[model samples]
Target: MSYFGGQPTNPFGAPTPKPPILKRQVPPLPENLDMATLADIRCSVNIFSPATGEIIEVVVGVEKRKFHVHDQILRSGSAFFKTALSKEWKEGKTRVVLLPDDAASLVDRYVQWLYTGKVGVTLDNGKTDYATLAGLYCLGEKLMHDAFQDRIVDALVSGTREPNNNAGHPTTCSFPMKDVVDDIYKGTPKGSPARRFMVDMHVMQGTSGWIDVERPESVNHEFAVDLAFAMMQERAVTGETKTKHAELNRGIPCSYHKHGKDGVCGGKA
Candidate 1:
């Protein structure tokens, strides 16, 4: 039967969307009254090397250190844990997983992000940050952390596309140092989005020739091959060619120095 004008209401039957869970509760709930499902809880897990009993191992040159981490947080966001922590696996039985090859600091940040959804990488001037992001992206790919991978990609793109970063034209921006680019190409797979984006950035900056001539020694051979292939594909489909008369503006800082003080080279004068 119609309630008011002739239309019936179904407020009780209509599904209501649930609100997102807040990271922290505001004003705190009363301690005396408690709900089993609404309380903050901690479940600890061991992530250790089988022999060392260390959660995370970091190696620098010849020195190594270990870390301790929680289980719920690590398991929440990483697919690598799904199988690694399964009942049949030895890691599941012992509550430990070995990561001897990974950098400790990067793994630390990844664990923190698993808990807080925030990566603690600093981007003060954006110079070293690219390498950090590239490394994190590689780690994310290795760990099958899709969300973290996307986050790193967003950071990389935004840093390069910063308003003052355009040099002169909006279509142009900065690139990473030779070492950082090399690390990215070396760790990432061919046709990775991050790698492809970097290639596209070099091309879009009208710096395709810049890659060929200016400091070609700095470029990695494999990366150069990938860039060439990407450029060829870009040309074949769009018929766009590299700019023959592109200017090499010495006024702007190179990829290594733009993140330095006053946008100067960080390593050299």
Candidate 2:
């Protein structure tokens, strides 16, 4: 009996092999993991203009308006502040920054954008105050925040179109000021979104000529060249073969298109 009942007599005993056991692989944790420990930290900041000659003055513009702002909010919104307020910088130590180039009005708007994510845009008579937009855009560019730049562009584009009239007629588009156009071109680098936006705005309005004549004295030669180049490129890609045409067969009428009986479209075929 070879260790079993009725088993064959073993000429030679052989050992049975067992299946190999597998172990799960566990990843090692990093020695120094970054955490969001500072999310709840709050701080205050002072903004000053260089003219005031004091970091704590928080002066802005020629009028010398001052602003006491929250540091965490400003730092979160601006790449400029994030770097400027870093531990190694004097800005961080003093919690103060001098914005010599910024106007008081514009600085106020920037602070508002940080806190509320809104910029005051006034649109009137198919014309937008590009001056404000340009100033804000420049600040965003200087701070290296693309999102801020985009917000300004969005506001500009949205504000350019007029509200529908009572008769439902589509209104004329806004005309950008020469000062606004010039400021953007002067401050932004070549191929900047704001630069291209101004070019497109002019082109779409069929007023590329405005670029040449509007505030000629303030225009930089390089800016003019760039504008011309942008216009040419835009035209080349957009294609200018089609002429403006009107539709006569559509069933819908609207005041915006000067179609419907009451100056409103019924959305019919």
Query: Which 10-residue window of candidate 1 scores lowest in summed lDDT?
Result: 1-10
Task: Quantify all predictions' global Cα lDDT against the true fold.
Answer: 0.54, 0.55
Per-model RMSD to reference: 16.8, 24.3
Deviation (Å) of 28 in candidate 2: 43
lDDT of 1 by residue, 55-173 (tens): 32222212344444544434444577656777798877777677777786677556544433444344555332777778888887777666667777777776665544425565545
What lDDT tens digits, residue by residue, belong to model 2 across residues 114-233? 443444465353345567788888977787666667777777776566543533555645556577777887778888877777767666675645655656766667666766786777
lDDT of 2: 0.55
Which regions in candidate 2 have their CA more than 4 angstroms from the true location? 1-58, 62-64, 123-127, 163-170, 208-219, 234-269
TM-score of the candidate numbered 2?
A: 0.58
For residue 259, what is the lDDT in candidate 2? 66
